[model samples]
Target: MKKRGGIRTAALALALSLSLSGCFFRGADELYAVPQPPKDYEALKVRLSEVIAAGGEYAAPLSGELIQTVQLQDLDGDGQKEAIAFFRFSSDEKPLKIYIFRQVGEEYEVLTVIEGAGTAINCVDYVQMDDEPYKEIVVSWQMSEQVHSLAAYSIGPGEVEELLRTDYNSYKLYDLDQDNQQELVVFRTPTDGPPQAELYDFHGVLGKTDTAPLSGGITAVADGGVQAGYLMDWVPALFAVSTYGGNGTITDIFTCRDGKLENITLDPDMGESRETVQFYTQVTGTDINNDGIMELPQPTPLVDYKITTATPNFWLIHWRQFDAQGEAHPVFTTYHNDRDGWYFILPETLGNNLTLARSDLPGGGERAVTFSYWEGDEAVEPKPFLTIYKLTGTNRVSRASLPGRFVLFPAEGLAGANDANTIYAAEFRDGWDCGLTEDEVRERFAIIKTDWLGNS
Candidate 1:
């Protein structure tokens, strides 16, 4: 989920003034003045085609590819929605057109047509600043191979005004702080240097407030999969940044403090591949300890690999707790493995309690497993469960259940189903907790074979 609270109320007022100047109408009566477009997709598409063709500026036919890109969204945040049509005129030299139409009575009327935007449009989304009623349309486009553009426009009654535009490799809208407002994060890569990331305040005239240096330079990976997501819900949201193809690798944790992006130091350091075969930089935001605050699960690494042997790999995992100072320290360590040929389930809080057991299945025939229990209280039922997951290509497939509490065993221990090395059996129990010793847990959930798999 995205963090909230970055836009300041004062800045929002200024942005509204600048964006709506001489264009926006005050009350609700102005909205119904226009006619609504036909509900049919074909009819709407044809109407948009005729409107563009009537422009009379080098009118070339719209391609099937371009015509199919039209979409409907409430760009203005009014109760009623609007249709946005994106199409190319004739040649690559001619700029792309974005036509916004509003529904009036029984017909659609052209609200505004944005011309000469760029050669190609990449993506479009709605962005709201603070508690503002209207949302601005954020458009990202490509002017050329080296020229990428991002612009935010305010759609008023019959006009669309440019709110903010910047030349960056990519852009993201997120509330870097937990204040319920959003900030614009833009990344730029120079042809000769390391990548740069800048944070901008969208409240006023789109001003840059903070900046940081990225790990890999732009174009380091052909389709560099740079990801920016929430890590913790601190006063200012703590976020993680992973470079291209580094989803399961290393991640850099950062936060915005006093208009600057500062890195939150991890004790043993993260993203180092020498200690383990694989590591995770992506931290999930969840309340694992049942404390109101969220905890960060440091990426657990898979250790000890023997490709030729039957011994399964184990997950070396750690949980990090954040102090009031925004620092994180490792609090717990556990070992887990996937034995049932199922996907590994990541450890997370189930219901109101933090789950002690978790698993990871990173594919390549590797599996991760975990066992967890939910004790009965005055309000709930006692439940025990096991989770398994396996990685299929880049996707992690998973299965979990309690069905009267069950356990899975490796194939060598079971008499029947010899072809299948994994055996699943149900164990009905009251519940379990930290008080239960490891040996007691194993005895309670018994197995005939002693050396079926390695210790979890």
Candidate 2:
């Protein structure tokens, strides 16, 4: 679901060093001789130190929830905690090993030492698949950049049993069929064939119950792409934001129907705006208004500039959602300024019959944007109702000195480059009835929280 890898992998060594007091192993010198850990971790640290003395190095997981080299969790529902540790040996066929140890009086005893596949650990989590008293230990292993395998093991007293294992590009654990139980939803973007979504049931014998074709253009799932939420406040849906070519990303929504996984965006009955594709920007489905249902964004050109221009200056993004009965609903509409990184939510009274014009200010570097009326082929005879200025450096200082204008500095969180030196100043046209007062306009402005620009 929420992407957890990448940066965490690079910080593993640092994290281990900082967590040394909690029995997280460090480098070679400190590994074998753990010097006076905390009282609670003294016994576990001694056991781990003995393991390190036998030429085993503490191995932190490259990705997933289990990023630490050692974790304590009650895997067998035995009330007492068990230590699960990962290690890599210099001389071993399968270098990576997962050691499970239980507390025996003052010291910890090894319950099992399971050899793991792959060069690194992708992720690890304990999940309750069925009505079993103990949860299944689920781990995803990373062999290479494109090769990954997932395994689920059932752990009992002094034993481990492998329940299910499969190779998948990405996976989501959600209740697709609404049976009050979680099912494994696996996505595959293969090199040879079309992308597919498979639904696996782990009730008794783990098997694929349903299969559906994903978007042929989808290449790989984007980081933090998989999202599980209700569609239109009713239908259960899994929104998978995927990358295709270099700069294009699309969202493919999957819902369970008749015990089969179906990509509803591809279903012909789901209305015309089903294909949620965006270029020059990657917009994922998000619950904009905290309405429970996630809305997919579709950048619609202004009515007047629909056909004439190859490049429209501004776009009115319509945050929409699809219903089960073949209908699309617009939940929110806003002017998304990706360049300066801000959003102006359009009010109901303003509607979509407005035009936004950008003009360079007097000093060359500064610019002002104006929103006016544009209905059909005629422009409304009035001065721009709302004018927005992006002020930077000296421009920000000059505007802030102008008594009332300083209050409008930094509208909604549009703090550009240097926060102290940048401001988004909004000046509403006075004495003009644009159907909304100045206070209403200020309430709707917001900063784009997502880093759509990909700048660190």
Candidate 3:
């Protein structure tokens, strides 16, 4: 939690082209081509080379096992959109890098990277800080030494900075006091150890952590931040942690000021297994409803986390998104089912009829907030579709094949946004790597000002 400085960023661009070879946006003709989503890897690489030749953008090296986190929010005040990217590299190394891109109209203009100060780190992020006018990105990173760190990145201008960094770690962000600003809540024990549930406030200043220990292990973390039209003055945050895993047993909840943990109900799967004296924990926090600006979900609320001993499945991993104001009635969840894959399950926000990509909304140059993804299977050939969806009274994802929704950047798997509609998605670079034009990557995806959620 701190204000950012441009000392590292202000000189990255000019000095980069001189020192680095073949940077994505550098003067090199051959660009570093990352794999693009929805395109065949072979073709994607080829196209990436071409796009690289076209645009000189280059991304820092990322480890294959690293989890990539990307989010789209118009960071700069100008209606154009930008991206916040976070990824890890060198499983042997502890430094985690976070990037911020500021797009001037269509091309990327400003970029900054966050170099992790601690140990080898693995991070998983969920953007929850809109409490500020700009987009706020938050995540928890486990240090190479086994310590967990929680931090937030607020995107603005062309630079990125650490809004908050906490040694005390938890699985979620919540607002204990109903002020709408989120908090950093977590529990930790030395390094590589089970954590208890604790609520924390993001004091932005480093080395400042307020802790209230719990009586027992944590279960699931949650809060009633949002209720029927009322943002609760004091959101009840819960954490489910126990000393053992399996058979599901009683969980505990901890408060910030008072170091007390209370026994709470937990999911049967959260119970202790045959392991004795060991603790299995699950944490999840919710604001469920965020009415655009006012609702900053879980100041650091905890939610059911996947920290089981069993093998983790990417397809089975899922999370939730809520409109500000609170995670009240209109909260939606990402459902990862065997048949449906991953979906935004919204019974409150989307009714029968939903509209996607309306260019005339009030913010920034009046462009639509376009959304796109692949509809085909990864194991087989790629079959991708682009569509748009508009929010409905009943809260549903009704789709429409909106025209001009895809902003095909000269690259694949790349996305850029300005404002809501003034957005661009880096398009397919089908095996055309090494040499291409910026105009070419620009041609990759169809730059459309159409709806974001499209017809299925």
Q: Which candidate tops lDDT?
A: 2
TM-score of each: 0.54, 0.79, 0.37
**Model 3 lDDT on a 0 to 1 scale:** 0.35
Relative to the true structure, how large is the alpha-carbon lDDT of every model?
Answer: 0.46, 0.67, 0.35
Ten-residue stretch with the least lDDT total in model 3:
392-401
Candidate 1 Cα misplacement greater than 4 A, ranges? 1-46, 49-68, 116-119, 130-132, 143-147, 191-194, 215-238, 244-249, 258-260, 266-313, 321-326, 329-456
Reference-based lDDT, residue 22, model 3: 15
**Clashing residue pairs in candidate 2 (N, C-alpha, C atoms within 3 angstroms):** none
From the highest lDDT down, the ranking of the candidates is 2, 1, 3
Error of 2 at 288 (Å): 0.9
For residue 418, model 3's alpha carbon misses the true position, in angstroms, by 48
Which of 1 and 3 is ahead in lDDT? Answer: 1
The digit string of per-residue lDDT tens for model 1 on 170-202 reads 566777665566777776766776666678775
Better of 2 and 3 by TM-score: 2
Q: In order, what is each prediction's RMSD in angstroms? A: 13.9, 6.8, 19.9
Evaluate model 1: give its TM-score: 0.54
Q: How displaced is residue 305 in candidate 2, in Å?
A: 8.3
* Candidate 2 TM-score over all chains jointly: 0.79
